[model samples]
Target chain A: MTRLSSAQRHLVRFTLNGKPVQGEAEPRLLLTDFLRQTIGATGTHVGCEHGVCGACTITVDGELARACLTLAVQIDGCELRTVEGLAPAPDRLGVLQAAFRRNHALQCGFCTAGILMSLDHYLRAHPKPSEAEIRDLLSGHLCRCTGYTPIVQAALEAAAELAELSRSDHRDV
Target chain B: MKPAAFDYVRAETLGEAIEVLAQHGGDARIIAGGQSLMAMLNMRLARPKVLIDIMRLRELDRIDSTSGSVKIGAGVRQAALLAWPELATSLPLLSKALPWTGHAQTRSRGTVCGSLAHADPSAELPLALVALGGELHLRSAGKQRKVAAREFFAGMMATARADDELIEAVSFPSGNARCAFREVARRHGDFAIVACAAVATKDGVRFAVGGVADVPTARDWPRLEGSALDDALNGFAHELDARDDVHATARYRRDLVRLIGRDLVREVLQ
Candidate 1:
């Protein structure tokens, strides 16, 4: 059998953080590599390339996925969200980010981005998650520092803040 | 580690996918969710000349429920099955077992049929399929066949699926049986050291044990009360010949199978 040359590349177009993005990559290029190198979205870290660690977790088409395990070409027409997309503005952090900071959820900050991204998507579906449910979500992630106490606290606070913001928006309308 | 270079072809239909698989034969591998295949490829554990991406075959992504059975397509993601409300009622054992297969992110892209086809002995899907008395539908270019879950899984990471055959769907018998799933793992989403799935019917109970044998094993038990059931469970556990692994000793696994088996059986019976 003939082997495909590593130099062979394919053109891929997708929506990244609500903006159209296009790049050239090999069919074997992982989404984590494409995001970090091609599109320059380095917030999605590659901890364990085998998908055991959740550091490369991102949202593909609004669903949480491990970028390291997903092929770049497979998400050709999908919308993707990385940790860079989580901030509401350049000057200020997003609600979850602010809560993370307030709760001191980071020590080394390596696993923070992926944890934030996972919780960002999780809290959307479960705005009022119980403590048990929060722990269950955190089970997908691995954090060596902070012992997860602060991270869980931050998630709970963010959920409350997000819920409060939605309530206020409804009141104003 | 990065995966070795491989050509990719996205098939627009099931027929096209089958034709490509036949043409490439052993050189090509079908990829649905890429949850398991990608990991293998990255580790250089598997390297094929071509990857036949079948995610575009939307025709193989439906979930159909008919009188006492539910057919889940090969492309149906694990998370989709978990979220499907009908599954809770139709296949209660599967619903209880899916969450333990992997975390939310992995389940979001992992396919139910892919997990079964991968045939990992410690995987929750195969154990649940065996306990539920499921049948897998395998299709080639012009021929198709159904294999029982018990017979389909030959051993760890092995199945009866031929090189040219694709798993089109898996049909599971649905019933009003009470069910329970229990597994002891290092973490919540990790592979189980010993996993047991039990489905209790009015007549008796069907018990399946994973991570303790070459392949997941299922047995039907008649209604036996008190010491009779305990003695039977002990004998069944001893028959497994559970092997020592990095995670556990053979004796530990046997003990877990006995203890967890009785607990799960009792839970389902209740």
Candidate 2:
């Protein structure tokens, strides 16, 4: 068993959005703070630290999780993905982001990063997700803006686009 | 809110975790999935001097389905149980209620044993466990014991488990009993305002209610129909002592008990 002192900062190393990253964190340091403060990746927002708000949603080892609920030391050596990893390039928005833009899914955009991360992970597994499924998946998040109708539309559209892209890639292969 | 400073230990084995718990007792807390515990830590509801990480204990991460019961280990996440191939066939009630436990994101990280450990009055897992008449396997450094689901849950956010004991696993009996689960929440994946689970027995159905009382409560009844069922549900609802919270009124909760309780009992019995 590996033990770290609560009072001292420990070296935490993990793969961040496919890149190896290391930071120092005390035992009480939440993954949300570690990502935004230590690693300097502010894409993963921290709204409600108590896990009720889905603003801090990210993926640990490719599984969707709330960053606020996760301790930084716990994710050691795990592959972590946040909203910053969504886009393929600096200038290009990913398919899901583009869909959100087209559908006007986000208004204030506070909840967008977490929503995008969730949709990105969910759509990959459920490429043929129905409207109800999208809404169900989205229940984790709370958005005061856009009334969720546009967000649902964007998720469905993104799923279709992702499915179509995969089919075409198969054809090309 | 941020958690108070505490030492962290990533336990490589169950034995190591037990040792740590033995040393610190109430001063140490077990972290498995850390869904509920982390939330408490953030809110400073629970402040342990040391946090033991048992997620890495691969031996504890198992879903062993025997012919009689489905035993879920401490490391079994809510998502893993939901994804289990035999879950629907073995524990239909869990399959129905697991989706309502939490959102997909939280479910992916929340452990089944952890939920039972938290023992939230309105939580689905504890209700399902009680309704199914499951057994919780608890172990300490020196001794191990099995506690019945009905006896395990003492009260709201409370269990009979000792601080030195870690819930090793929980076993739910596998049967062909028709089961039904219904919940009324502010939103999907939210904590249930009133959750009910009914399981058909030989002579009658076992009805369980959550969110209406301090702990998930169950009542066994002979098969009844129409007004008889309604009267029984009403009596049970009153017995729960539903409280008025920000999400709902006590009367509204009792009403749900009568309405949703009737629906679930009938669905399972039929």
Candidate 3:
């Protein structure tokens, strides 16, 4: 292995949530670490660092990506959205998060954030997904506590809520 | 787990990337999506002295179709390829196989060329590439060459690519062939114990199996119906002599191969 000095840090600038954020990171620093440590977006949890678990999932440039597998430098100019960005207000939960809570989707809550992020991205593209489609989307995420039934229920409810919101937005337009 | 300390260079263009690869020799590893490489690095399975970040090589991130053939550049992510509107009509086999490659998040960051280069025996991309009979374009500092997919994979986690050569693009011939991909994994997104891809064209049918051997192997079969195709696949499965591991016994894998092969062939024929 080639040893770089501990002082080595590269500057990365990217849009976090709706704000532009910049930080110094090692080239090998993962995007998960960058979000959690440097920018203090700790809502993006890290379970399996090798990209198996979806705990470190986030959206980069409107696409769902595994933060554990992405380098901080790779998203220099990209827009990123972590779990923290899910809520419309600082204190209130987003539609997906509220549906997850209402449906008892989380037991341990460790996997909830990742699931929320993934479902948020999926539901954006598929506003009214079926239960089977929700289950297929959740297959990417590993949830040990919820037995996946409640999580799937949460996703289905969230999809319904999102579809309603889209319809209302269109009506308002 | 974190990756070991290494020098990182973001190559701007293909020529520059090839120069860096040539300069570093075997000490460097090229990273596009970094899905597989990051996992290997975190596990200490790969210890490269230099990481050539080819993610910025936008010139290679194109999917071009010309004369009934599609050329996908190395930097093209799996999800991007899947999202391509023309992919379903141009390369139906790849379109059918991409969803099984990984989850949405991983596919968003994993590149098609990266999967081909990683060369895991259980990986779906290589199996699909072989089944589709794709061609890999490799480039060095001063030379470029195209290799057939059948000859690209050497063994488990090994390929015919030279240390200095960079996979520039992969090309697949376009045809309206009926294709099907089937795999038996422990879970929805997990690696398959045995996977098969079958494509039936007017000429003949081609079948490739993964996770049963060191590398995905493909065989051409004549158009046969019913029990004849099943018997041929059964014979082919026995000839594979797949290895045994913690996940499954060699016999189980062979059986899976035969079953999946038959199913896929039937789907293609229909």
**What lDDT does the true structure give each of the candidates?**
0.88, 0.92, 0.86
Worst 10 residues of 3 chain B by lDDT: B5-14
Model 1 per-residue lDDT tens digits across residues B1-270: 998888888888898888878887877788998888889999988898788888778899999999989999999999999999888888888888888998987999999999998888899999988988889999989999999998899988999999888999999999655889999999898889999998886688988999888889988888766898788888888888888889999999988988888888888777
**Model 3: per-residue Cα lDDT over B86-134, one tens digit each:** 9888988888778889887788889999999999999999998898888
Error of 1 at B218 (Å): 1.1
Model 3 lDDT at residue A141:
90
Could you give the TM-score of chain B for each candidate, in order?
0.96, 0.99, 0.96
What clash count does candidate 1 reach?
Answer: 0
* All candidates: DockQ: 0.51, 0.93, 0.49
Model 2, A1-173: lDDT tens per residue?
99999889999999998999999999999999999999999998889898887999999998999999999998889999999888878989888899999999999899999999999888878879989998998999999989999999998888887878887784210
Q: Can you tell me which runs of candidate 2 are displaced by over 4 Å?
A: A170-173
Candidate 3 error regions (>4 Å): A1-7, A170-173, B201-203, B225-228
Query: Can you list the residue pairs that collide in candidate 2?
Result: none
Query: Could you tell me the TM-score of chain A in candidate 1?
Result: 0.93
Please tell me what DockQ candidate 2 reaches: 0.93
Worst 10 residues of 3 chain A by lDDT: A1-10
Listed for every candidate in order, the interface RMSD values in angstroms are 4.1, 0.5, 4.4
Model 1, runs deviating above 4 Å: A1-7, A170-173, B201-203
